[model samples]
Target: AQLNISGNVTIHRGSETLEDSKLVTELHNTEDNAYDIIVTENDDESSSSDEKEEDAKQIEPNRIEEAFQVKYQGTTLETFCSRLKLFHDEWYQQIKPYAPYLTIIQSSGSGKTRLVGELRTKGIYILYICERHECSSGYPASTPYVQKILETIRDYKFGALLSIAIKEIKNKNWSAEEFWNIQIKDDHKAECNDFWRSVFKSLLQQKKPSSDSRDENFVKKLFHKASIVCCIDEAHELLAKATKAKDDETYFVKWRRQIRDISWVGFFNILLSTSGKIGNFLPPVTQDTRSARSHDFVIFPAYLDVNTMDVLAPLAENVGKEYDYTRVVYLGIPLWGSLAQAGVSLINLVHLASQKIRNFSKKNNDHLANLACMACSLSLEVSPRIAEVDSLIASHMATALGVSLDRTSILCTYPSDPILASGALKGIIDVGWENCLDTLLELFSRGVVEAGERGELVNRILFSKAYADAVRECFPDSPVTYLQKVPLKLFLKSLLREEIDGLDELLNRMGIDEAEIGFNHWTSLLATNQKYVESGGMKFLTANLVIEAYHRHTAFKMPLGFPVIDHIIPFKYNAGYGIISIKTRIQKKTTFGAKDISSLIHPLNSFGKWKKGYKILGIYIDLGLDRENAVESKAELKSRNAPQTRSKNKNNEDKKDVKNDYDQIIYIQGVGSFKCCGKEISERLSKILFTRPWPLDTQWSEFDEKTDLKREDVIKTFLPLVFEQKQSLVDKWQLI
Candidate 1:
């Protein structure tokens, strides 16, 4: 079988894998083609796992002859060319500072390089794609910028055009560096401009070697073109490297002068390309940084537009993974599209962007996770931050994204607080609360966040800028404040719980001890699946019992937290699919009373129907100090009022409330595990014990035996109305 190699390779990040027939084969047949798309490897200074994957996709056979991949082969490329030819001069003239530079500040991997290369394929006359890539990280990092530029220029076909223009149309051509000094004159000086025109004309003639007459006409039209676009790719990388040395111009400043010189020519326009949520540009040698010997250029601005996501959705799927809001959060930064293409998952990529963000090191933040969870509980949809459209520039930016740019409408990007030209879009879209909650849970998975060694019970959690950004991007900006406060008003009726307007009041402090840390973690786990409390008006007994539950967890050396609604609070930790209730020293019936039951359904509806926005998983009541009087029980061991056995008919008046309103109901005794002294001193104790709390002769009861636990050390009383959803906690949530 003939091995046909398509240009696109299905690369698996650090491990290079070919698409089905993916192979990196070198074309030993580059001699015949004018636009040679050859693949080459560049040495990278980073870890072995990383490569110059972006440029490695395709490199020009001849480094000096910048070739573009015809990604927008025909229609898109043609439109861009026609537009550039028409507006290059007009765009320059309209600018206030009038630098005559096209100034296209594109983000990384948005195909600015491809745009440069495509101009060549279109047979544009005066276009030049500089090979001096500003991302000089690999072996090229050691080479001076000016020296590199000189070397690349030294390779151009100026010599060929000089022989044809200055003398006659002969086959003998020489390098431009030999005859005209571009190092001194810049690219667009009067004499230098004419020399490059001859190069383009000759190249065109060579393109159609046999059709001399047709070549002559085509050459005339292309050469006589009024505009020239000099694409200085990765110019932002150079701007940041700018230094203010006293004696002479630093390489960065020298490069800046070259750009300025190129822009001064009336016929020439320079497109300054870079990427990110770029704000206003400042002079490279700002006074504040002038005296500094070293500077930090790091920024981790990860933002996403749902509309913009559509543009990249297909590309992401092709790489064997589909990105959701959570993926977008961690992988949505600049070059994220390309990184996804390469199948890499380096979260630290954002660290190298700008020094203005956080330390980039990740750690657990229970408070942050709770804040995110709470916000999600309170809101139904996230209000997206849309970038403003600058009628003119946005349209042009749209062209890059292969979208029809309209003066009135476009996709605004997330990084764009001050939208200029970006991956921006304008539209109305809602991020549902369910998805946000799911993303939050996926991010803060207790299993994923843990101690550094071989199981330390609980290590740092995966609560980072990514998760918080998602909370901001996915959840509504404010509490779904439009929500009717009547339920909240009634929810507030319970004198035992306090009010928390927002996160500001909810936040405690920055840091806490590992004891509290484990407590909070355990609390989150149990809240998902565990029991609640109730007893006679035995105030001191109940208090001691609840305290004992806390002490038991601390003694067991497990992630610690109270058995209250949320570890220690009497509110919903997560809305709908959440467990909420209040604790008090009220008279306890053999079964929980209606008042006690209402605690589980607070934020409930007025019609006695549980019609609040959120859904109830079940009621968790901890009947601290309530000893199970087996001697006084019925003789039919199974005849006891176990939830499921007692109620099959939802129509039963008294049972209707529990059956129709709740998904599950769980009951338990408070305060036990303190028995595991020195915390069950094991090499790596299983957290399975966290959910399986033992009573001081503490206990568990049961409903439909299908979903109840009967561990020797634990007592579980479970009534699951819905078989699938109402399983034991760990299994339902996939905690294992």
Candidate 2:
């Protein structure tokens, strides 16, 4: 009993164990079978023939015991076993008639291989295959890999017969891989598969009963009795070529097609593991994650959480390491945690963590760049920042990533006050990994101050103010520097440094702010001159607040051509400041139809020649005044600024003749790059997007307000007297 128990437990994965000599001998005796290259060493000095013969006859033997250091076994080792066993019993065996497979999603270096080692420590038979190298059997359908799997089962059966399961350091059956991949051919394939299957059936194993008469409970129990499991390391590599595995043309509409259908992959009891996002990997219709087969293989997330930190920092309770708990839980990858075990200071660890995260973000297509930016924007607050996310994903983050407080916040984020690391994800990018777009929408929705609903979080989305320092260390730019850079999520926050919103007020709040630094707003978003702040340095704004932002940015890049650069300007004003946007139109018969005119109502898409003029709605303002006619070529416009004479016969194909007559053309005298529209277009707009609308040709500088204007406050100017409309007509005006 003792020999059978813990028989297969190796001190570590890479143990130095030679193959059993008996198996090699037996295979050598088999027809066309040979293995094990062995060599005998002779002493340099030629020994006497009689002495050598005596030594060989006496069978000289050497024995030694190797010392092995047992690393920290996490507190959740039993939990790990329980989770896998439960999945195996309940769901894994339920489909035993078909295929039994489980997927374990774990981040890289989170001890996934070690966890399998732990199961082996209990004398469980596990065939670990490195998927990247060994999954392919050189056959079209991986016949050799599967054959080796059966052989591994037979080897275990031999161990059971002897009541002594041998433990080896090697992660897999290397000999099997060599023989199967190199020697096995299509001609002998059927014979080889038959031989392996017969050997597996005769092995001392728990025989699974026929499903015809066995009850569900009986079948599950039989599965539980069958302790053998095949775990493929880096199983996600099998999926790298494909997105979804099931009934789909392309695996994913967003990703590549022409991939294999892995939906019917479960040929035997298998465990597919990865270190990517669970929400992203599982197929929905067995491919789409949103509707992944719940009845299918279980998604076991082996996250490195606080228990891991406790294991690393055992004396954290006696010392003052409780304060650094959150930090370790968040950034305590095994490699970094080992540094903590060596008594590295918390400050050094934090600096190290910040650098690693930054470098990682930069390398992985900068998917986490927006997260870093959001962290910086919210870093001035004293308390830990929190945001809601999808409950299922949030649960994974909490347990696996160790970010949850109470273990359940399934609505948006798991645990109402989640671990601060919850904010970082790759969901926003088009070509990057999974994202958390909905999370951003949820957080921003609550942060809307202008909304009469006045949701929780009031005007602010709580975030660690000290994280701003981390962001600066990583990305060295202001909070709003990445607005257009992030085409997906438009995050906005206030820059006003109110004493009440200080970190000191949030001390009793969430944890993770071990630095406990109180920050003041030392950065300004806007200034009058270009010498002060750059256009990229402004605070983020939504569609409604975009006109002001458009004007500010226009001060930098004047005369932004069509498809109006007004995406920086927003038409919607529901969120705190207004969400700005830009739009493009599909023309009807090359004629500006009602649809074309109507497309501009949304402030983001409206035709506003950025910065100077009114945030025009309803129509494309094709300015048609000779002195200020918008030319097709920028060089011609520049030449006009210098008062260059026109060549009558320049053969300029770029010249657009403005022929159609319209209702109104509000031509500003000095402002060269401005927009004007017909009377119908003007009435449709009716002074909506901008703060205050005025007649055409008014000095672009007249409506400008610096400092004290509440932003919404209309400037009371000296030129209140309305000027009579005197504008250029659009009938046959040749603009060069």
lDDT of each: 0.28, 0.29
Deviation in angstroms for 424 in model 1? 23
Per-residue alpha-carbon lDDT of candidate 2 for residues 571-656, written as tens digits (9 for 90 to 100): 22212222222232211125433443334433334323233223322213222222223333110100011223443347754544
**Cα RMSD (angstroms) for every candidate in the order listed:** 23.5, 26.1
Estimated TM-score per prediction? Answer: 0.32, 0.33
Estimate, for each residue in 1-736, the C-alpha lDDT of model 1 and write its tens digit: 2234434333332212223222444433333432223333322222233422223222211121221111232244555565564454453354433333444434333444444444544444233433343232211111123333432233333223222332321122323223222312223244444544555555557532232222323233434432234444434444443234455434333333333323222244444434322222222223323432243321111111112222333343324211122133122222344433444322222222211111111112322222222222221111121232221112222112212212122232222110110011000002222333233333223322121121112111111111222233333443211111112122221211223232121121111101110111112221212333232221111223323322221111111232223212212221111222323211244464554444444434111235444433222323232334311211000111325424446565444323332322223222221111122221112221232222321123343555444442332232244233335777878898
| Winning candidate number (TM-score) | 2
How badly does each model clash, as a count of residue pairs? 39, 38
Alpha-carbon deviation at 29 in model 2, angstroms: 49
Model 1 spans with C-alpha error above 4 angstroms: 1-95, 102-112, 115-227, 236-245, 250-281, 284-310, 315-736
